[model samples]
Target: MILRTSRLDLREMTEDDLPALRAILQDAETMTAYEGAFDEEMVQAWLHRMRDRYRDDGFGMWAVVLRESGEMIGQCGPTVQHILDEDVLEVGYLFNRAHWHRGYATEAAAAVRDHVFRALGADRLFAQVRDMNVASMNVAIRLGMTVRGRFVKNYRGVDMPHLAFAIDAPPTGREHGVSAAPPERRRER
Candidate 1:
């Protein structure tokens, strides 16, 4: 699937994206939100798993590419996750350190949130944010999601505390921060 925003192009992940994916996922500083950086083998497995997810679930995290430079900056999309002991559609994202602070994560994530409802027909979408990930939590808020509660996840023998943020499908064409405009002025591009 291809999704376009003002600055990004989100598409399905492929094996060819391994090098770029590794650049982000394998960087210790970039992956500090998680327990640690991923190894080369782990990066391969991550790519393989996403490919399998495409075939099995028909949806998965997508590669976020820059439209002007044509460089992949990150990955973002929907995934079924067990949060608060229940299955929920979660919007997850990760970006290269070099691309941070440019609002790429927020833009990609907002588009994915819209897709999860407008295209996927889901009633609501959620994001799982590690407690320490203030940046990501801010992104979730910018997507118009509200902090629901807290939960703990066991990752690599570490007990990571996380907060759940969620937003339901817009009632009609109302989207947070999107003003009503004439067709020519709208940002439906």
Candidate 2:
């Protein structure tokens, strides 16, 4: 599936994205925010695993591209996360360091959240963020997600606090401040 925003294109991952994905995954600053740095082999395996998820589940994290430049900036989508109690479809994303502070993550995440609820019929969506990542926390809030709880676990063998956020359901027309009918219909064409 491909989703488009004003300046971005969200599409499925391709084999050609391996080099870009690997570079993003290996950046020490970006990896510091994530669990750990991924080697080239690990990155390729991750791509393969995501491909399998797409085949089996019909959805997975998609590559985010710049519409004007056609450059891959990051990935964002739903994934089945196995936490302590049960499995849940969590919305996740990561971007290249060069793409930071541009609102790309928030914009991409908002689009994904809308798709998950409106198109995928997801009743709820969740996101797990490390406590130290203030930027991600803001993204969760901007997406209208409320923190459900936290877990103290070893993420990539480092003891860190994980914060979970969830949105119960999609917003209705009224919630979006949009009228049910078109302006021409509401008035007189």
Candidate 3:
């Protein structure tokens, strides 16, 4: 499956994307929210886990490829997260540092948000933003989300404060559809 936007094509990642994945996941600055860069083994496990999510959940963070360049510039989409003792579907976005400062995160996330509300028939979408990461918070805000709660997440051996952000599906059951661009997909294998 491929979710297309004005400039990106979000699709299921394959093992062949390892090198590109490393460039993003293994970069220290780009992964500060993850606590630090991942080592070779951790990176491999991350990729395998995403593929597993595809098989088990039918959706996961996708490879965000720039259509013009065909380079995987980031990762964005939804994942089921256990937050505050509740299992919620959350939208997530992470980009290579080189691609920061542009509006890609917002564009990609909004597309995924719309898809969940429209195609997936979800009533609400969520995002868990690390307290200090205002940039990511901004992306969630741009998707029309507002902080709904907070919690401490123990990840990478540290207690991280996170703000839960969420937006309900518009009453019309759709938005203007920045991400409503048709996707090219075959039956899941």
lDDT of 1: 0.91
Better of 1 and 2 by lDDT: 1
* Candidate 1 TM-score to native: 0.89
TM-scores for candidates 1 onward, in order = 0.89, 0.87, 0.89
**Which residue pairs of candidate 2 clash?**
none
**After superposition, candidate 3 runs with Cα above 4 Å error:** 173-189
Clash pairs, candidate 1, are none
In the range 95-127, model 2's lDDT, one tens digit per residue, is: 998999999999999998988888888888999
lDDT for 116 in candidate 2 is: 87
Better of 1 and 2 by TM-score: 1
Ranking by lDDT: 1, 3, 2
Q: Which of 2 and 3 is ahead in lDDT?
A: 3
